[model samples]
Target: MKAARIYLSVLCLSLGFLFGFSPAEKKSKATWIWQSEIIGQDKQQVLEFCEQNEINLIYLRIDMNKPSDYYRSFIREATAQGIEVHAVAGHPAWAFTSNQKRMMNIVGWVKKYNLESEPNERIRGIQLDIEPYLLPQWETERDRVIREWQANVEAFTEAVRDETGLMSSVALAFWLDDIPTPDNPDMPLSKWMIDQFDTICIMAYRDRLNGSNGILSLIEQEMQEADELGRRVLVAVNLKKDMNDHASFAEEGVVEMNRQLALLPEHLEQHPSYGGIAIHDYRNWKEAAADMPPVDRDHYKGTYIWRAETIRTEKDEILAFAKENDVNLLYVRIDMQQPLSMYQDFVREAKAAGIEVHAMGGHPIWALTESRGKILKLVNWVKAYNQEVSSGEQFHGVHLDIEPYVMPVWREKKEAVLRQWMGNIEAFVEATKHETNLEVSVDLAAWLDKTPTPGQPDKPFAHWMMEQMDHTTLMAFRDQAEGIIGLVENQMKYAQSIDKKLVVAVETKESHEGDFITFYEEGRGEMNRQLQLVTKALEGYSSFMGQAIHAYEYWKNGKE
Candidate 1:
């Protein structure tokens, strides 16, 4: 029988946590969709700009025929920042045939975003995008009859949504002749088209519409017609050039931009079904940040705690690790003594490794012992740690890794010092708790297991270090193998009794000792076997859900 590895992704319901269906292709809230459309800067930096501005919605343009890694970082960054993204693809209406290959691609996207699962699945819905402006030059070549196109749209939507539960929407030219428009005689077919979608975005700009009709007026009219059919409306107002060969909002027509924006709320009031707006391009909206509100400082302020530098190395390494280990939960460290600027190499490494790292903050021995004159610098270190964790993707959670040390004779005095030390630590944890939903975990001293105490309902750490983390590990190694196993098992049971998560940590340093150590050194079997066994052993004791290896370097070296 195959043994399942302990992992959070497996147990947690695969809900729509990332992408969703929307008529508009918006990159972020800071994006005004009025001017500019090119995202050439660092992906993380642009994403940070969004977080700081409290922008959660984003639209990414990807080729339906070709796939690339450019969107990988965008998706990762969006997931980390809790931003929801929708994908828009450009293809001729002819490409969406009722064939099996196209059917498979649609299903693949649904699974990739995990939209077919329970709860807030990654994708809220899919878009049946028909950019009429990009239509074939000859009207005869393009299928103008909305009925023919509607059949394929509904087929593709059903195939993808039946498995993923993603809602569906469509984008179409706002010509009075479009399918949902009541006056259109060619396809007065509202039932067939409207039934397949949760919403429809009237592309109320471009061509004669942009020149003759104001955007707000078009939105009001389409929304009224959509509501009459009991369908939701998503307004696609233009932020760029129009059908009249006029310049985009940025290049030539800057003055009338804000005037157009002021009409959005009024249009919504006029036609309440307006779901939201989708900007033309991501790069354009990001460039317009200069005219928006001040960047939000608190949004990106926090600390990251990592488990290894290897998870920070390269994409192949990260992906290989995930595939080999059947897990993607990566740990990264954020040292409070080191400035966040110094961790770029680590962050880049992790990003390359495809590892989503969080941070852990604490001072080095040197900084903690420095004179009082360095107090302000010390405070800045704390603040910067906060900012980086709150902003950085490679850094996932706030981890405090201060080795709990006390000589056997000075144990009492050390405990008092720990209490005093934790005073600042407590403030840091509490401060972080209020800011982000990122999970918080800590590495505590082994001595917390010397005597176990009961944890309160909400306060698990009341008895030990587990209180400080959403889940925490007791680095148990260097002792006898059986003893090490026993300690971890006990913690798991106790934590489970209190309804808290317990992480079983295995040190690679210990795996290097004894018989298994010699086998590990000789490469007799898979290093993953050790990982699998420990995970199985813990599962034998309590509700074991996940396992965290000690260090990336040690694991890479095949050490126990």
Candidate 2:
């Protein structure tokens, strides 16, 4: 009976191959290792995590700076465990015509690395995670951005065409199915991508397995497209805690996540295109599985320093005043032309004294669409500065004080200005998203709570702004606690609903606007007293992050 069974199996396999049918394919269970540096730091821990989780494939982010030996060791060990490691690299900017070279650089590097490495240690494939939809231009210039993105994709495909056995893949958003292809409007962008790449990892980041908006439903179209094209598709889920409840399994815990994931093979095995599941990243998965404690949010007592030179000239006085006033956060203005050493010293001292310093810059014109380069310049400067500085000397966040309302164009083109402002904010967030340690914040006027968003009238513009940022400082500018609380009541409710942070701000500059707008005449004693009342009033609101004073110069010169 055993001999007959073996004979039958061999015969069936041979006949299937001859008849253009393939035997049962092994589905790949994959995950992404975004922090490539982790392999150098803790390779064993990463391997053990993958081994324990039964992961057979890893899309390891390539850090070109790291020596090839690190990747060789990791890939060799991974291959020994029946796992295949693919090189992963990308950035949103790479979708632009000017940045296509950056995308190709990854291809060039991976090709070189594979050539130098042993067969078992070689990278099995390459995956691009570039999502051009995150760009601000995607909203205002959708057609142009799409064309450029298509060109980039074509360039990428052509670049890798000759690299044999290097399976090409891309991590794409599921909604691309709704977008028509640039050249052929009849076909969906998702289908175009499916045809271009060997495998498509659809980021179907829903938490549940079933429902109209669940993981299975979201990837249905992509799966069908991939099936028709005879390509593989991996359903990717986010494990990051910051995503919305439906977008991640962060709150559901590993056991529940696994329970839902185990159902995938049963439902998807019928489709030959279903390649298996890919988690968003390694660090978040490990941390979530370990049930790590949440970081504490200390109340922010922040003040803005408009002059970059103040940090160098008044370092002693600033430190003394901050110590006396219990100030924990400072938004210091950045002078791009100044040497980074000046700020580094101040930041290091401030950090040692338990005060976090954020790089601050903005102008009224920055909100204009034409001024996007300026924003990118600042973002790039901060990123570069951070790279050059030590941890203790690095800026903790970025604060934008771009008051578009101050521009004359705001009065003439209110809607246009609002649209442009929104785009700039999107650009800022996209540029900063990868900086995991840097927080993004903006100064919002209190009256914005009453203004309706340009297209989203059901929600206030303030709510939309708060939703984009990690935290916002409401320029309530009221002298009394009740008045300040009243100005930000709607924002507080919205912030609490979204689980975002809000910081109430008071003015110290002697305002030509109104007496109630500033604490300049009220003296430091009265200002402190009023702030205490405001803190007490807002204590019950979970979104209340504490208070901020307007300007450092004015606050220091205010009445004693």
Candidate 3:
């Protein structure tokens, strides 16, 4: 019966080869590694190693903190090299928590990512690492725990399939051979798990194939069962030193590990289920020794500023974050005081790194008749700072964040304040162009169009601000993308007529400003997704430049 089973398994695998495996993957070796720590990787070096070693797949952790485009860039490059990439993550409780909302969260995120990503960048599969046996409740409630875990596994896999429409896989321990199921105590654990997931990554964790605990010994039966069931089998090795010494090739190092890995397929050549070798994680295996620069784009991606003090204090961090988010236009504050050099230094580096540094600072009073000179001083100071620095090492433009409604003058006489603010802005705009050819941009509340003009309340403030400045950053401030787009729709049409570029600004800062104004409650991922909606709505409009996130400090710390 065993011989017959092996023969039938071989036949099934042969058919799988005929119908399932991609020709490129079949011709190339199916080496893979898990990138548990993908943050600091030199993308080129990692891809080079994979190409040289014939690594066909990488199990990358979804960097939920970064934007979706972040993963898309790397995945696109990997797929171009004929390497497959899958989103991988696990937490045992994720599968069984009330509502299993966390599992749904993962599924939702991956689904959105796929929808936003290109064909090559879309995930090939989702490798779930829900190690239920590792949970504390498993030991005390063995039978019940096993049953719940089995159910969770099946449920989670189903969700991935039905929701994401992507192939699903799971990491399993090699010892899970014959643990009985609650439904049928005689059922093998391997059989049940293999049935639940499309591919089983066996955590073999042994260095050699001779002893009872050897890598081959552990998976010999697994491969046979895999062949019989038409399930794909992949053996994994631990690269970390803290694991059982004999369980990994940590002491032996990468050279020896690669040498041994080369011989794996040969030993299991006859096993129909043998797919490939997957190193446990990139972080550990990479030390066995050997290796993303960001991709540049052609867009005026920008951010708004409510905190120049924070930028000056945390310049390095702010600069790094700017590059991570691919920000080009930087709206920061400038003063002739103590931190003057900080401004110049920031502008210098920004120019060197192909980023624009625009000086930004304004008060509501600066838009009144008495304070017209004050706003000009800010602009003149920016012009002088530009002259002080090298030709390119200066403020790219000047941005005003003066919102007259915030002043008591507006309540006292709304139209009177509007007329005065318009007059002050007219003088400031003319002076800026006359003094320095710098492009002037102002930040305005998105509801400016809805706000009634003083005596002529029928005509919105948007009518009076025609060609008032080169660009306008509308503070749409809504957390959700749809609401934000709605806020800017009328302004977008007006801007196209007036020939002023409009930047739809969203609030990512956690502020008590308003309930729906800021995405402070939402993480960077959601914020990024929301921005995509803004871009899509206003795409192809010369007047619609791009979006501006509320501020850096709030966006950086909002996740906490």
Candidate 4:
């Protein structure tokens, strides 16, 4: 009788705990994307607003346009308020060569406000903006002008380093895929400028015509390409404008925020080569978010799955998991290596499964190499149905699969031959948007983190792709290792802080070690664990846009 009474008590207690206990709901963490448009009185108010609202990262433009005291006071105030100051040279006058007074003035303020020590490192870094005007593509005398500016900028940076020991960085012209444009082989100025700067910021936010808002994949392609030309690299995130503002953003207008947040972790996992993100301006974010609809995670879940490959089998597996677990989003992958005919069937099945698809054409390089115009023709075929296949029903984007161009022959002919290579893609993307209204995306090699082979000149590829593309899908699967994780963290943190839409391309491969450390075998369980960790780590920061698993087949096999 006593034993029965004890058992009943224990059962009641267990039931009580089970019924009463609930996991804490996730609080919305604010990303580092901030507004810089608040000027004069408005600026001060916004800074205070950020502080009150717990905004830790702040972006500002301290140029000739603003008074000297304005910048000094702004930095000082931001520091006191526990906000990190991320500033950019606003106008041409702030350019190192053109505006000596302004350059020195800004450097002095940075030195005063830039943090070196203890509890709060409020001032993160200074950004030297160098976006070229489209109207004046190249100036005959502009080369000389650039040369002068480069020298002064280097000197100014050296002065800052001497004082603070913190290396100064610059945001260079986002365009310029390769040095010595095919037209002017003698132009060493670009290369010279690249060498002078501590880190190169590739602005990967052009290519608006190729289906707006798919900027992360474009950034990845550029990062890989830039790896060819320069070693030290970072990327810029455009917090404003979703593919020219025609294609709408997620309800929260938090597309950039989500993209960067997701990107930083994934990039850290795959590519430690990235420095971080250089946000365009704080104001753009402020304005965009205000007009944004309240975040609907349900709709977010729907938009999240744009490419669901082999949905008939995979969709059911994913749906079962999502339903059982009450998960809203499911990561999907598709490859060009797979037959084009399978796409329609996959789409139909995915829809039935109640899964949203984020389809990326897995292998553009392989497909193009195999038939030259196969992808373009596939787009044509998809466009054949204007009804069932309204623009939205087609895959969310195409994933361009390009391996690092390691061959010397390929390197030498980069600009001349690759002009057509890029042209074909640009044309294909433009035509696709015109027809399907779907965006195009691409995957890039995580090659930038390593040094280029001694003989290769264009090793850092981000320098190349930044010139043309806006979206990038980066492979960031190996970043969790201790040696690599720090690099990954810093790079992703920086990317998120800057506000670019970046997707960390995670690999479904795993690791196993017995006899080999450097070349150990990979496993499936490890890949799944890595994905969960990467996603969890990148929760709050902006600049992340979901993730791209290495391949659909790899993921499916790993589960099996």
Candidate 5:
């Protein structure tokens, strides 16, 4: 057992929480389908559509012939933003193949893909759509056809459990509940699906829910059975236009469809298995829903994750607080020995909450002398961990907190140490990009703008760092709002031109350096007031990503 050694407690369900909040869970809010047609097209549009709609899951049609890297890249990027991708594929015949060979092949393929993938480049789960209803004599010979279909599902599920190590989901029609199995005559076919698979997606398909056979009534039994089984049901609506208009939202337009979809939670969320709703395909959804709202801010408004408390905390509580406070990013250190399962859970929760977890740890010495080897090891660790965990559970990026100026080498030769620091950061970024596709960020002292480079005496060191790195945090560790603003004001002014994202961070951790160095004594309430002031002051710069608290321990301690 690998023990995760850390000064702080670290557990997250997604985005890999930095500080030590212990637990978090997500109720699937939104989901969508991708029918593989958008594979080569403008994929960015689909991602944007999901982001805007707050879609938490995607059922992507698995084109088996497609290269592993192709799926890896898309799934990796999708998961980083909190959208999970499950490989969905099935022809009615696939379920009937000799020995369930087709299902075995898919499992083998995903296994190989996982073996080869960089961390974050793996699929979340397996969702299959083996629609036996499409067979030639479905209307004439329904009973036998349903039983055969049920047998196929059993075989496929067995293979998934024995070989793939992935959660299983089966696409189902709302009326599947009408058919019951021989062994369990009382159990509905829909209930059997829920009982057998990790998740069941009821293709409700209808745009309305008022009367009998409408969306709600169709899935009522599935939801009830799922709740009893301690499983989940994903309600799927249609965007496919050629299908029945009552089933597809296409004819209703975006606004009316959204109104109906919103009522799902109103009626069904009371059930334990009410995971969320999923639309048929992204392309159709995007084309038809032109009036959906746009995402507001896409920058860093984060906090320092710390774990300096005697009492434990709930991650759900912390996440709730984060949402209310507009904290979307978290910076924390990584303990290499951490259990892979723990990080996987953290990343999932964080992504669902739309919070970024940047792995935050670096000593000045790690950058100062002969540190390239150390840097490589660190990058490798992130790569290993990211690869080891489930898709969204991987770290969002690296937040290197290497303050070289605080070292003795900086005192002896300030510019040389700064140059070494910049070189180390550059190398880390290069290696991280090569090893893992996660975003790279570093912490900088605010005064770097005033401190000129060693050889180029006229050019500020901050400019060089800015050119080398795009996402950065300025350690404007002042207690007062004015002091914080004054320190990072120049960076705020110049960051736009350099095309960099700068997070202005203040200290809340208790510091022996100076009383004015931190707001730990002032408390979280006071820190919030000062941070609000800083936000107001820097409202002028669109490049001002936002502010960050030093660490969770001090922040939480202040609350106490």
Candidate 6:
């Protein structure tokens, strides 16, 4: 009998492979479309999004009131693009025996729709998202509620089993494994649900992947149970903004979310029952993606204007030089002592010439605890200036070039200096938090990634700064692209993980520090050539914004 069973398994595997239905075939990428009317409103939008995201399966919410043509047309188009559409409907109240009819109505509708539609337009599956745990009765009469939920699920699955080609699935909470089955105390509710449904989508919502409470760990039991039963399980993650940071990737942006999702296959492919990943719903996921800042790779050619007097004395010459060098960003030094009209006129012209002007000021003393007021003074001055100027004349952002390491106190009290620097940054960010349009950015040394935070040894100071600011300009200050890339590699990875931006800056002024530290000796052609190489090399990193020259004076002089 054992030999016969082994032979049967081999035969089944052979047949599955021959028919292109092997259990180890390509994993399915699914998503939920909770708004049924979206199909009737703009079906092409949904189809195109699915195509771009490589979604092969969709649990489309069913609204029986709509005309059948909507589903037919959407499903037919999806089918042509190798996508499957499944009818989905359910509510917490549907778990009650009295609401059994409401549950049956969905099964009945899907059956009727599939019967009338052509092969390509047919509904491929039915998924019920009933969550009895959300009902108050489940808390008071837990046993009774469990019995009723099980009965409803049994009935629903039985009804679906009669259908010819329709599969049955359920969106189940990952914690259901802790609940014992009413009929078989040794079995888990999750296991029972897996047995009853053709597929189970474990709602294992989490932002990270490896912790005790992460997505992988939360769905381990469910995946094991499904594999033992030879069933399929799709891991689901929430993208809704309503969820906490740990529960959803809404705040992490699309690039980080994709970075996390891309690792699911490597960690899950070993399980025979691992189906794939499913995003919570379409609308929120689309909105979260849209919120991400568009990456204009290699687009920003920037240089600093360190002297405010230069903008007044050589306004036309500066604009002409900026245009000639394709400079889009100018970190113009803010001299609070100078007249505000000088900055207003210069910024207005810079805007007209298609250049973004950011107010810049910094000193090594600004990192001292006693000098925190100086940091806030700069922030307040920029804020006040922005409020006084027209939109075209306002500073686009505030950029700080503070190098606290240059202070003598940094050598005597390194940790104290780091703490004070962090405090100053916090003050700057707090001062400008209310300025909705004003971006807060700073210049950071590339090697800061090696310095650990005071208490959190695992997190680098560079990462913490990236988390607090809108973006950071890394002072790589290396003449060659290879050296510059190596210097900023760790910070680049951290920036990508947190969805922050980094602009790599190279020194052009002759440096007494080291020959490798500045491109001043390399001249304009070599600097431009090396920067182009850096851009091409770091093209894969979404965090890499572009390259920046140290200052307009030296760069322009070198060009001469």
- Give residue 51's error in model 6 in angstroms: 1.3
- Give me the displacement of residue 494 in model 1, in angstroms: 1.6
By TM-score, the candidates rank as 5, 6, 2, 3, 1, 4
Q: Which ten residues in a row have the lowest lDDT in candidate 2?
A: 15-24
Each model's Cα RMSD: 20.0, 25.7, 24.5, 26.4, 10.5, 23.2
lDDT of 3 by residue, 1-560 (tens): 11134643453344334433222113223334454345335778778877645577788777576788777878889899878887787787764655366666767788888998889889888888877787788778767777767766777788788855688888888887857776787877877888777788998887776677788887877788788888787888877885578888888776456556645654775776777678866667666654123323324677755555655677677767877888878888655453554564566556545577778888888768888878867765665445444343468788888888887877888877888888888887876676466888888888888876666777788656646777888888888888998888877787788777887788776578776878878778888888887888888666888777777767777773
Backbone steric clashes in candidate 3, count: 1
The Cα error of candidate 4 at residue 409, in Å, is: 74
- Point out where model 5 deviates above 4 Å: 1-170, 173-179, 182-298, 306-314
Model 6 per-residue lDDT tens digits across residues 412-517: 9988888988998998887666534689999999899988987778988888889999889999999998999999877888899989989999998998999899
Residue pairs in steric clash, candidate 2?
none
Instruction: Choose the strongest candidate by TM-score.
Output: 5
Model 2: CA > 4 A from native: 1-22, 292-560
lDDT for each of the candidates? 0.47, 0.83, 0.72, 0.47, 0.72, 0.83
Alpha carbon RMSD to native, model 5 = 10.5
**What is the overall TM-score of model 5 with all chains considered together?**
0.59
* Residue 210 error, candidate 1, Å: 36
Error of 1 at 117 (Å): 32
Error of 1 at 15 (Å): 35
Per-prediction TM-score: 0.42, 0.49, 0.46, 0.39, 0.59, 0.53
- Candidate achieving higher TM-score, 2 or 4: 2
Look at candidate 4 and tell me the lDDT of residue 126: 65
Query: Please, what are the lDDT tens digits per residue for candidate 2 over residues 100-147?
Result: 888899889988988998999988788988898889998998888888
lDDT of model 3 at position 15: 35
lDDT of 5 by residue, 325-423 (tens): 777888756665555444554555656566777776777787675876676566656665665444445687876777777777778887677767767
The better candidate by TM-score, 4 or 5, is 5
